[model samples]
Target: MVPVRDELFARLERFYDAIPRDGAHTEAFGGLVLFVRDGAGWPFYARPRLDATEPASAADVADVRRRQRELGLPEAFEWVHENNPELLAVARSAGLSVLEAPLMVLDPTALPSVTELSDVPVRLLDPAAPTFGADLAARRAVAAVGFAAPGTAVGGAGPAARDTALVELPLDALAEEQCRTESGHRISALAELPGQGAVASGMAMRVDDAAEIAGIATLPSARRRGLGAAITAALARRLLADGVDLVFLSAGSTEIARVYLRVGFRRVGTACIAEPA
Candidate 1:
């Protein structure tokens, strides 16, 4: 059998390289491919191209960062360290803070026991569903609320906090979410309260047998209730059931990676994310 590490990075390069095609286009800078957004929406980052063997130069990283500043975009870069180990030094040399997150891959056969979350029902969002029109905005807004505070640590914030954030959630988020779904991804949302809409959500981006679970978040009010894990496991099971062989994600931190570990994902490598210093 091919090594899981090898299989993971090989598939990831292709997945990451191709993901920008939907709402963004790629601009080549040496061995790097910068995912530049076509218009207003969530901005993408730079990465080593699929065919990249040698590490991109520090000049390439600086050039990309300069281009980002010119375009009024964030100086962000993401890469699987094992796939292009030398890029880490290049990014640091460019005066960027590189956070090495746990690069995890799911073991399909060992997924956790998902007890029925009746109170906070989680389900995959379908563009074809009749109720999709009514559901899309709220679910997309939940992500903005969840990500604003970041992490699993809960506080007094909850439903009302989400309500305050709803007005600030841009229409661009909905458009971006739509673009991702149209690009062959499956989005899942969880509604912890009956009267309100979704409070936790995530998506699985798939191409052939490779899928990456991302944007998994639960509202500050709803944290520590296993909502993030539920959304993750739901998306993972959905992808595997549909024949995806490799499912992976990059955790925000080591503590957060433990949440995914409950759902049978193990760290296979490091996911390097670099941003402005």
Candidate 2:
């Protein structure tokens, strides 16, 4: 039988291509492809497909940078696999910073039994529910705190600075967007703490028949209590039950990756995010 990873990788590539651009233009230069949405709340980046050739030339890098500048978007590139050393070298030489994360996929046959942590009830939020407004506030608060915590991969700022920025976001709108099941995503959170609100939360985005689990976090005060794993497992189980063929996520670190591994997620490939130098 063929490797499951190859099939999943292909599905991922198709998923990226199918992302509704909402009128944004996409152009391909050799093996590199760029998506430009004019900063319309959609991702704008250059990416190399899994079957791309080696030795991404300096000219290719320059062309990508030129297009990004013309669109007035920051220069960013994403390499979905580790097979692009040549492209990565070209990107880095041109002053693009890189962050590498391990891509992980869940093995349904190996899934561990879901065990809810005591006193930490995990709740799936319904965007249409009467209490959605309050629940959304609590969910956003937990996310702000979790992402701002020291050593988080996404937030590079100090806690105070990150908190200030996160609080200013249009969270009401965000909550509305995330809670819409018709929008192909779902949000879940752990029970509220006495003063900290929701202590753990995560969301899943459906791409074709596969689901990408993202934004999983546990507040600092709730760390080490298995709340993170509990929420993750719960989300995975629900997605599988809903007929999602594949579920994957990019772990922020080996420590975080280990958490998913305990729940049957296997290492599949490397995921890279490149930003302007």
Candidate 3:
């Protein structure tokens, strides 16, 4: 396992702070913190201060739960570091289920040389642009299909259900929220396949000095053709050019991790997402 650097972790902390949790509630107690973003449709866990001057206690866990109830969020929803077994135990004792994945980071010096695909055109979509609404809808459609494909993270959802949920998403509101804060910036892009509107799509968000690369998906018919890699590399390069140096993402699986590794990312630590059981 590549040791997680303190600076990288600090960046992660800031990135969390920079997220635009519009119309959300936040509470902090000792080593624990929680955010309830209604628009996000999920609650998020702030990095636990397990290593703070005072260790996390049962009181903190109780307080976090209390806040969750107040916000009407699910009984449990947290993003925690796997290294903190103490925190994980507390959440588990509270009846939360945990799913862990690798936290990967890209070091500028190790960026791989990814050749741009000439035949496939990849371009960034500006959220504020006039055509953003239609483009975003198309991108979300592609994402829903990608996520429902066999072997993907959100796989069990059949295409029809996935498409329905995605199509109903408030893309306009999401676009507005992504750009409302100075700390947040979202870049959406797509790879056009011959005769297909878009076969591959992804997005990256830069919050202050740190960035997260997410939603990289290629349609089933477009897999193994490097479209995913191309989109990821393009987004990363754009973020780097924009002056946000610390870039990271959570890989859903080892195969996906391998895809990211080709673009200079290395597994640094384990990231765990826990939700009500």
Residue 58 lDDT in candidate 3: 64
Question: What alpha-carbon RMSD in Å does predicted model 1 have with respect to the real structure?
Answer: 2.7
Considering only N, C-alpha and C atoms within 3 Å, which residue pairs clash in candidate 3? none
Instruction: Give candidate 1's TM-score.
Output: 0.89
Which wins on TM-score, candidate 1 or candidate 3?
1
Clashing pairs in 2: none
lDDT of 3 at 111: 69
Tens digits of per-residue lDDT for model 3 on 138-238? 67877777866733333333334434545543765664634642234878888886555676788887776678888888777667777777788888888
Compared with the true structure, what per-residue lDDT tens digits does model 2 show for residues 36-149?
A: 774335356777744456556667777888988887877888767545656677777888887778888888876765564335667877767766656655656666678667
Q: At residue 160, give the lDDT of candidate 2.
A: 38
- Each model's lDDT: 0.78, 0.68, 0.68
Q: Residue 134 error for model 3, in Å?
A: 1.3
User: How accurate locally is residue 116 in candidate 2, as Cα lDDT from 0 to 100?
Assistant: 40
Least accurate 10 contiguous residues by lDDT in model 2: 156-165
Q: Per-residue lDDT for 1-277 in model 1, tens only?
A: 2235666678888888877787798888888989998877669999887766666999888889889999889999999899888989888888999999998888877786456422466777776676664466556667778878877898666667666665433566655666666656655555556765677877777877788898887878778878888888888877877888888899999999999889889888999999987
